[model samples]
Target: MLMPHPKDMRTLLSRYATARLAHAERQTLKSATQLDDVSYTLCVATATTEINDALAAADRILAQPPPAASSRP
Candidate 1:
């Protein structure tokens, strides 16, 4: 899969983490909406349709020594 630019990928991943944390804490309407937005954005950035798939795609892109990297699971 095509990878996002290094800096952009970091931003996407950071947003993903924040949105996920908000979700895990509680599924409030606002947080849920934010998560949906972030998830959709992440999906688009990763060239995926589903959230899990998008996450995996992000992880894969991040795993390679992308000219850098992260630990996700």
Candidate 2:
């Protein structure tokens, strides 16, 4: 399986975490009756797709060779 670079993985994870926090906050702000029942479902679907894409990209990166080191002394 392909692996993501460390930096890329961190960034992708951060974005997903931020989005998750935002969704939670929004849910907390609304009263039970005021919240849309489908909002959580939609958010989960969107975030799942984005996270999966990131994972796939990371995997692709893993399949590539590492960069060559410089020969300069």
Candidate 3:
């Protein structure tokens, strides 16, 4: 199997983080009528936690060296 380079992984992770943040904002907006100020703040905080976790995982993956290519006959 082919492995992605660290730079590529980082780019993908960054994009994912952006998407998550946008989604969170959209959700907050959509549910604004149902949420009070404190609730909205909590929702954003939860979303941020999720985003941070994903970024941390991605960083860990990117830190590892790419697998060595196999030699073929």
Model number with the top lDDT:
1
Which 10 successive residues of model 3 have the least lDDT summed? Answer: 34-43
Clashing pairs in 3: none
Residues 1-73, candidate 2, lDDT per residue (tens digit)?
3333444444554555555666667756443323332333333433433545544555555566654555222
Overall lDDT per candidate, in order of appearance: 0.83, 0.46, 0.49
Rank by TM-score, highest first.
1, 3, 2
Per residue, candidate 1 scores C-alpha lDDT tens digits across 1-69 of 556776677898899899889988998998999999998999999888999998888777777675523
Candidate closer to the true structure by TM-score (higher is better), 2 or 3: 3
Tens digits of lDDT, candidate 3, 1-73 = 3444555556565555555565567766634433333333332433433545545555666778665555321
What's the candidate order when arranged by decreasing lDDT?
1, 3, 2
Best by TM-score: 1
Model 3 / residue 68 / CA error / Å: 11
Question: Using Cα atoms with residue i matched to residue i, what is each candidate's TM-score against the true structure?
Answer: 0.76, 0.37, 0.43
lDDT of 3 at 32: 45
Cα lDDT, model 2, residue 12: 52
Minimal lDDT window, size 10, model 1: 64-73
